[model samples]
Target: MHQVHVVGLGVDHRDITPTASRLIDSAEVLAGGDRLLALFNDHPAVKILIKSPLKNVIDRINQEMQSHRKVVVLADGDPLFFGIGKRLIDAFGKDAVIIYPNVTTLQVAASKLKIPWHDIKSISLHGRKDIQPLLTALVGNNRVAVFTEPDFSPAKVADELIRRGADTFNMHVFEDLETETEKTRCFELKDAVKQTFSPLNFIILNRIKQAVISLSLGLDDDLYLHQRGLITKREIRVAGLSSLEIEPHHTLWDLGAGCGSVAIEASLLAYEGIVLAVEKAPERIQLIRQNISRMCAYGVEVIHGEMPECLESLPDPHRVFIGGGMGKDNSVLEAATERLRPGGKLVLHLVLMGSMARARDYLKDLKWPFSITQLQVSRSKDLAGDHRLEALNPVFIISAKKPALRL
Candidate 1:
């Protein structure tokens, strides 16, 4: 039969059966990672598998199947659990393939640790969205399992989770699941910072919820998504929402879309107004996408790269929110304010002393019809089982109009 077979292998070649070994040895071509391919070292003509350049491998597989040659593709743990088998079946179709099962590492991990596998909430965060959604699903006291990648490995996840103030969950990490050198590491959610982990590791988190910082106002500053160390305060966020002036068919620009607060809110406001949230960081770009999706702000479009460069292709603006120029030198706010049609509103926030000065002089030069505001916010806190008050940093705001900017 002209077909492809995807075979799963155990941690070691010794675990493979004679029939599977024979299929590997007699295959016309082999495709997989360096280690997986090396498992069949005796077969000298194995073709290497490269994921990004996927079409090349597909082309070879197609050619082999057309020639009626037997092809065996190798995969790790389970071919169906975050493995390549499903992609093969999807690409080549079910009628053209057969899958030989092997024990997935999770089974081995559970067996080795004597724990139940079905109870753990298994997720692959390799290229999945950040742990925010995963965090939201967390129960007060529960367990979570995650598969890791080189970039978003176990350590990185723990660091991010802790930063987001995940001091409520306990973590259990296991590495090299079924190998001779396998390892498992455990820690409480708050004590996670006490240790780090290896690159190849899986995570299990036990819920460890912290005290509610007055619920509504204290969105757990750690929970809001932002870049390298930048975020919008809830107070400023509420204010920006006020000035968005969103309406049906309105198109808004959230320049320096820190945590996508304005964009998400504008999307909520305009429901029909379009919000373009712009940011320069790759992580924050992804974060904005996740936040928009999480809030189901489908009307909001998350653009990658920097604002002006990223925004060059977007249609004209109806309203713009400048949240980052607080300290930026080559500011996109200038372009946004300039492009704002007659009567269109351009709302801006400046944080740095010098940036505020620069903004004052620049706005004065424009001499547009505008209104300026400064906010000194005080947030309530709890101390000694009583409510206390505290203040966040001060901010300067300006809302200008180009006088017929549009509906």
Candidate 2:
């Protein structure tokens, strides 16, 4: 079988290893981007330009392989490090592909700063639409390296961090790595957002200071920026989240999310997952954003629309929490329950006895096993310079799980 050789050209062409050079020399087909291909413009071989809708490139490579052509695919840095090597490996099994790795941009960038990179968390925003990965990367790590794309530039990344109030890190942007024109500059996230960078660039974020509020399973209600004490109490929030049985990768929908306290904490629990906080009120939507920013809850998405309607465009959820928006009828509850994934859990916080009865009846009609926990919390308050236990409004926690599919 003719094997395809994927070579990483490092930062400079002069650094190419002798073995990679020999493979490129013996190639009957050369595949890479226009910039990389320009290095071997004089070489007499069939050229395949790697372009968008990469399936075509894969097909052409497969066709050339059938003809027993020696194919050399040129790439930058380490081919397996967020490059095209995986695609080739997927197209043709690992046995059919030989990889020659060179020094990566991250290595060079870290070397210039004299910083050890093994501890650094690296993520690529290249050709990616969601910044959740980047946000999640910032959760525990003090340092993060990012491979930026043209559309999602360094400035855009800084802008996003600033928007989310997770901009505690200093931004280090490296431009044109390994070239004489290479330039590296460090900026505070606020300043980085206003600056432009070269197309060929990467960024590093180093946490400068601890966030004002340390995130945990349950945060005090006073820490959040809710309107008129409209946020979920800490006790009920924890209990409701526990009832959802959230996993690290579970997608959660906080329907009728008021002030977004539950959704914010849920995002922290489901670190690798997404949380959609659907709220119809504009004021509460703003409050949710403020709380998300304050808490540095990176994965919670504030969706400003009514339940059942907004739920249509969202992906199927692994956990559903209905805190409000049940309306005068049970339409929202019915809609949320029906949309829960098989074996997924649904939790609701209802203060009204009438609403709780309606929910019970709905679950009964569907023959779904459900449980309810009446949560009553009390906190001590100062009464005339002395502390006294003050009772909070009682809440009914209802939880149910959809049955898994049976063969």
Candidate 3:
């Protein structure tokens, strides 16, 4: 059987190489999206228009291949870079296909802007409902490039950035790249939010200004929007996170997340991981979202329902933090423990002795390795002409680890 040839068209028709031209000219059957196929309208090969329900297209390609026809698939840029080449390789193993590489849109965008793309984080917003990747990239990288889908435009991206208070970056929107009608424009997020562009566009975000909100592990309380006395103290948050022993890919849950302080900070530690902030109170849920944006705490999902019942729908956590949701009943604690993955860690913050006792007993029953830490934090206060240490409420942190599965 003849292997399928997947050719990348670079950024323009002129950019197609001699080798790729030879493959396209020799193909008995050609397959690609409408735009790519239009470039070769005069070609003699049978054209298969690639469209949604791509499974049909794959099946058709398979049928052609079985008939011993030479199939050529045209793709934009380097197909392996967020393009159809990977899907083809997955559909038919690597040995069954040959990919001809070319310059990607990211490379062209970088060249046009005269910026090095070596470190720029790239994500595609195509067919995506959540902008979590955008948010996450903005938090960690100085520059980000997005492959914009028709439905998820630059304006929508701007709106989300502005909403998250992560609008400190300058936006660059490239429309109809490499075509005769190609256009490039740059704007502040505020201005970008009000404008629209071609459906065929790419976005690059450059960090021009520092975020107004400070982002760090155990961020200052004043940086977050929360009701007075509702946020976790900075020191307690630090201690709790330390006890959770979060790894880069661990999924951590903040049960009864108040303004998402612990979860937001945990996101930094679990940078390549998932963090969920579960809050029951409507007002606090809003606050959690605001803090998530302000803090640039990407990947922290705000769950807006009560504990125990709400935790059921969530992915099992590798680390769990119980800050506020436990009532007189131990259902919340029980649920979190039951849902925790083996070798996972759970940490709880309590000011009340009764609550501490309940958590202690719960861990003891599970016979998990556990430890307690007493934290007494104080900040300096100006008394008259000088400063004095004003003590905050004492907090008890309980740390427990679920036993690993024995081999």
Candidate 4:
């Protein structure tokens, strides 16, 4: 049987290559969306309008191929990039289909922006309502392009971003790319929400101040609002987080999440993950929410209740951070360890030696693979006219990993 030709009709019908045009013209059967088929109304080929219930179209294409009839399928933009080309190839063997490539909408958007696209990230909200993946991608990326759908349009995206406290990005919207009625405009994320955009549009987000998010582990203690000096020290937070071994998609539990520094940092590291910060103090819960917004750490969810009790409703965690309450009641630790998914890691920070010893004994009793480190952090401070080091309180950090198989 002859191979079916799948042509990418760039942005406009005029953008179709001469070779592709000939393939379309000489085909005995043609299939594409209504709009695409309308573009070639003058063609004498038997046109099949592609629609929902994609299986019907597939069946028709298979029948045409079985009959040895020449068929051409029209696709918008480059078919390989989140397009129908791959689906067709997957259904029919690769050798049975010929793909003619063209400039994708992403490429056109980048070209108009006059920016390098090799380093940029691309996402399609075409049939997706979940923005979690997009939010995760926005964590450290400087440039991103999104293919918008009618339901999840640019304005919806802007609202989501604003809700996530991601005000550091500038939005550029491009509609009807490469056409006479095409429009492109840039706006601050705040203003983007107030504006209307066409459904046939894509969005490019450029970081306004790239330096806001950094790779460093310890953010300044002043960044969070805490009661007295109850927050986790910067050095200890850095030490504990380093040992937690956070992954991009891990669900983390931050017990006694005072000021939520650890959870916030974990949110950044586990951008695609969920971080539940269980803080009983009403004031602290408010502060954690504020800190999350300020840091643009949208992955964090503050639970305004005590740990162990609060953890009941949460999904199993891949990692757990016990920065508080473990010293007061080892039950929190026991609950966390019990609920931690197999092969997950748990890191605990304790300031008191008694609490440290109790935690060590509890971990040892469980016979889980664990280690303890004592951190003595000293910071340089200006005293008189000379710089002198001031020793902060020493803290103990305990880390344990759940075995893949229980004994």
RMSD of 4: 4.6
> After superposing candidate 4, which stretches have Cα over 4 Å from the reference?
1-6, 23-74, 84-98, 114-116, 209-215, 220-225, 271-282, 289-316, 327-339, 352-367, 379-391, 405-407
Q: What are the clash counts of all predictions, listed in order?
A: 15, 0, 0, 0
Per-residue lDDT of model 4, residues 1-407, tens digit only: 56889999887668888998888889999999888998889888888787767788888988898888899999888888877888888898899889998888888888998988888988787667567667767766888888777788888899988876777789999988778889999998888888888767888998886533353468888767788788889888888888999988899999888888898888778877778889898888888877766666766777887666878988899999888756456778888899999999999888888888898898889899999899998999998999999999888888999989758
Q: Rate the local accuracy (lDDT) of all candidates.
A: 0.69, 0.87, 0.87, 0.83
List model 1 lDDT by residue over 1-407, tens digit each: 57888888975546877787788878888888777776667777657574656677777788878888778888876788878778878888888877877877667666656778887776676555455335444422256667777777665676766554455567777876656877887776556555656665677765555433222322444655566557778778778667757675777888888777677666555544457778777778778766544443444566777556677777678898888765446457667776766677888887777877777677778887777788898988999999888987888887777766346
What is candidate 3's TM-score against the reference? 0.80
Instruction: Write one digit per residue (lDDT tens) for candidate 2, span 347-371.
Output: 9898989889988898989888899
TM-score of each: 0.52, 0.87, 0.80, 0.76
Local error of candidate 2 at 33, Å? 2.6
**How well is each residue in 344-398 modelled by candidate 3, as lDDT tens digits?**
9989999998889988998899899999988999999999999999999899899
Q: Which prediction has more favorable TM-score, 1 or 3? A: 3
Better of 2 and 3 by TM-score: 2
Query: Model 4's lDDT to the true fold?
Result: 0.83
List ranges where model 1 is wrong by over 4 Å.
Answer: 127-141, 189-199, 210-407
Worst 10 contiguous positions by lDDT, candidate 2? 290-299
Candidate 1 clash figure, as a count: 15
Clashing pairs in 2: none
